[model samples]
Target: MKLVVQVKLLPTPAQAAALATTLRACNAAAQYTSRVAFERNVKSRNELQKLCYREIKDRFGLSAQPAVRVVKKVVDAYTALHAGIRAGYLGGERSRRRVKAESKPIAFNTSSAQPFDDRCLSWRYDAGTVSIWTTAGRLKGIGFVGSADQLATLRAHRRGESDLLFRDGGWFLIATCEVPEPEVFEPADWIGVDRGITNLATTSDADNFQGRRLQRYRRWHGRKRVELQAKRTKSAKRRLKARARKEARHAACVNHSIAKDIVAVAQRTGRGIALEELRGIRDRVRLNRHQRAIMSSWPFHQLERHITYKARRAGVPVLLVDARYTSQMCPRCKHTTRSNRPTRDTFSCRLCGLAGPADVVAAVNVRDRARRAWVLVNAPVPMAA
Candidate 1:
């Protein structure tokens, strides 16, 4: 398992300036590489490296490691485009967008960090001081501090590739570390969790985790965002942009908390977790204007991601089951129909007359489906010739 540990760095003023200059140079080379690749119809990384390798080094005055990383950054941009194309999420044969060079966070490959090669990014850790390689040169005796838990991991696990990040007037080292995978739990019980817009999560045990507070929070910010955006003044626009980011961060934090609680409950019960596989739901399902707005602001995917990593780390298995008819399907009589759920938050089976909270019913169905999936996955398979 790969875990990224962010360590706050304390660099001298000279080192900070040098790091900034290096980042500028690296981004410039990356931008040139991006422009050339797009203009020349270059796709493969090998072709890109051949085209820009020597020229970038000479023109940008960058060392071999920084030059190569620049090419890699450009290649990564194209890679994202290709992935989107393959997934049918983008509608274009090729991406024509060019990278504009800016002072942004940069990644350093193992080649750049010659001395630091473990399962994580190699760093010379002495007491609280660390030494890392930068494009300018090796910056030694940079102070970094992390929590006790984080420091314990630093001392235990192997580090992988590291990134130099400049955020909020701080230069930080983001280190990737490889932690051994925990033993997979063979669950005898399963906890079903239904995720929705109004109620963030409803477990099979009938615990309803409502996001009314978050909803109110977002709505308040959303109104302010619209008001500021409509003004179109420079200050308003800046505040609007900052508000958008803050809103996103707040949403992510809420998702993390919800996921933590769900996973913790499942762990306490000694059971695996079951979630709905709501892939491409926005495209698959049609909704009215109000519904669409709610769906757009929903953080289901982020919550699922948080649950997955947390579950895995805690040795609790998680299963994603097809959510088709899970809401309408009656857990009592196994009758499937749209009429089963005539109203939101209420589920009443037309055939069996079973009634309960709609979300809890769906969660139960999700768990049942996941139980079947788990059985099927563990079932024996015949040999094929």
Candidate 2:
């Protein structure tokens, strides 16, 4: 499994200036390369390199590897843009959004992250420092800090390119690590997780990860955002951005905690994890105005990703079961209908008279589906006909 460990850099004023200059130069070079690619209609890395490599090295003062990386970055941006168009993320061909996207070349932010290969960057894990190439020169002995586990992971499994990024007045490196996944053991049972805006997560074990506190936090921030927007000052805008980042960090932390606990339980119990296949959930479900606001910012997918990655790290299997009617199905009688859920949180089967919390019922349905699916998957093949 591939994971990223982020380490903060503590650089002297001189080193910091060099880092900033390098980042700006790389992004500026990238923007220039993008313009060239757009004008020539060339999206291949090799072609872009041939066209702009010399100019980048001379104009941006970048070395060989950084020049190559800048060209690659521009090509990757175009590739991603084309992919988004194909996937209809910008809407139909004639849509204004799609037209606007296609009309201009992709742009890179001034502080956009830059990738550094081994040739341009080297880590000294023992000394907690790094040596990296800059437009000024190679900066050596720049101190870095991370958690104990993160440092250990970097020392053991760090591989491939690391991204140098400047964010919130700090510099950080996101190092990629390839960790070996343990062999998955046979499961004794399954733990089903139902994701929702209100409950956040409800398991078949009847454990609830409520979102009330989070909702309150968001509402407070929402009010503050409106106030700041009304002010419409530069300071207000900066504060707004900071608050948004803080809220996101808080949500991510909650998700990490929830996923760790769930994976721990699954590993300890020798059970697999079952989650509803919730792709395009926003399109499938309808919500009122207030509910829509909640849904728009909901981190359901992030939570699912966290659970999956944690489960993978723990050697616990995860299954995505069908999501249809999970909230409104009778777990005991297998009766499915809209009326089965008479209220948002209550589930009462009209036919079988089974009743429970709606989220828990959904989770139980997920577990049942995983159980049957796993049986079919591992069922022995019959004699050849």
Candidate 3:
């Protein structure tokens, strides 16, 4: 199976500035492309991806700006999309221009996206000494992880297959790598996953794997960010950089830990795993701004994705179940009522007097749905690894 190890990039100060400029250019590129696509009578099909890259060069492309393999990855996204469209995938065409409102102009704190393929593999992992031909000059030994060989499936780069982002003071590169065919297994046990706004997640095994720590860290970090922003001095700005670096490390560590835990639990059970659908979770939730953001960023989707791939690596079944009424329904008595869950973590059934932790009950219900879906549905199982 293929696994992508995104080692951090230690770009020079000049490289960092170029990256920031590239980000704005990318946003400008995407926005311009989007406007062209949505315009009613604009028939002159404009290729903004190429245009953006070219325009940025005209405006801010310094001869000394480091173009390295790192920034070219951004251009690769456009190339990949065009290739797909040529290959008959219409969706790729739309994604090439789907600019959302929140997509602020790419700035210093933004991560750039890059595409990867056999052609671009020249600089992907060329020994411990990494070098890329750039508009500026060759940058070497930036930081790389693992061998450069990639499986064909994951080689498809539609969106930010290689996503670079700036947050909390440092830059993070998240490479999207695909694994080989998944392994098939006869599970030894069964699992149910419950996702909720209040608690984040609860598993059938009574394991509480919520993002409490992440929330705490975000809160503390937010305060520090505010303190930094309140400052007008140059030194204070430098201090913010330190804080950002710390946050990036913490975020990655948190995500990796949560993913490992979820996978570990699945492996330990040696049984099929199931998770409630997250699509409905948001619609059903009435969350405050903070709660909404937390629920939205809980990484439940990423967790599910991590579980599926990790399970395949270990040979296990992963299932998804609809989440409707999972919380209000009593696991013991099969009693369903809105009154069954009146608060954050309590679920009590009026008819059966069954009371339990709300998330756990939902987990059980979700598990049941998975069992039913697995037994009766004809959905294709993922190919064995």
Model 1 lDDT per residue over 113-212, tens place? 2212232224666568766555667777778888887877877884655667775467777677688878877897899999998899999999888999
Q: Where's the lowest-lDDT run of ten residues in candidate 2?
A: 285-294
How well is each residue in 110-159 modelled by candidate 2, as lDDT tens digits? 89999999999999988999999999999999999999999999999999
| Candidate 2 residue 121 C-alpha distance from true site, Å | 0.9
Global CA lDDT of candidate 3, please?
0.60
89-159, model 3: which lDDT tens digit per residue?
64443464433311332222134443333232234443432343333444455554433433232234313
Error of 1 at 293 (Å): 2.0
> Which candidate would rank higher by TM-score, 1 or 3?
1
The estimated TM-scores of all candidates read 0.83, 0.95, 0.61
Ranking by lDDT: 2, 1, 3
Model 3, 184: alpha-carbon shift in Å?
A: 3.0
State how far residue 87 of model 2 sits from its true place (Å).
Answer: 1.8
Clashes of each: 7, 0, 10
Runs off by more than 4 Å, candidate 3: 1-3, 8-127, 131-178, 228-252, 288-297, 378-385
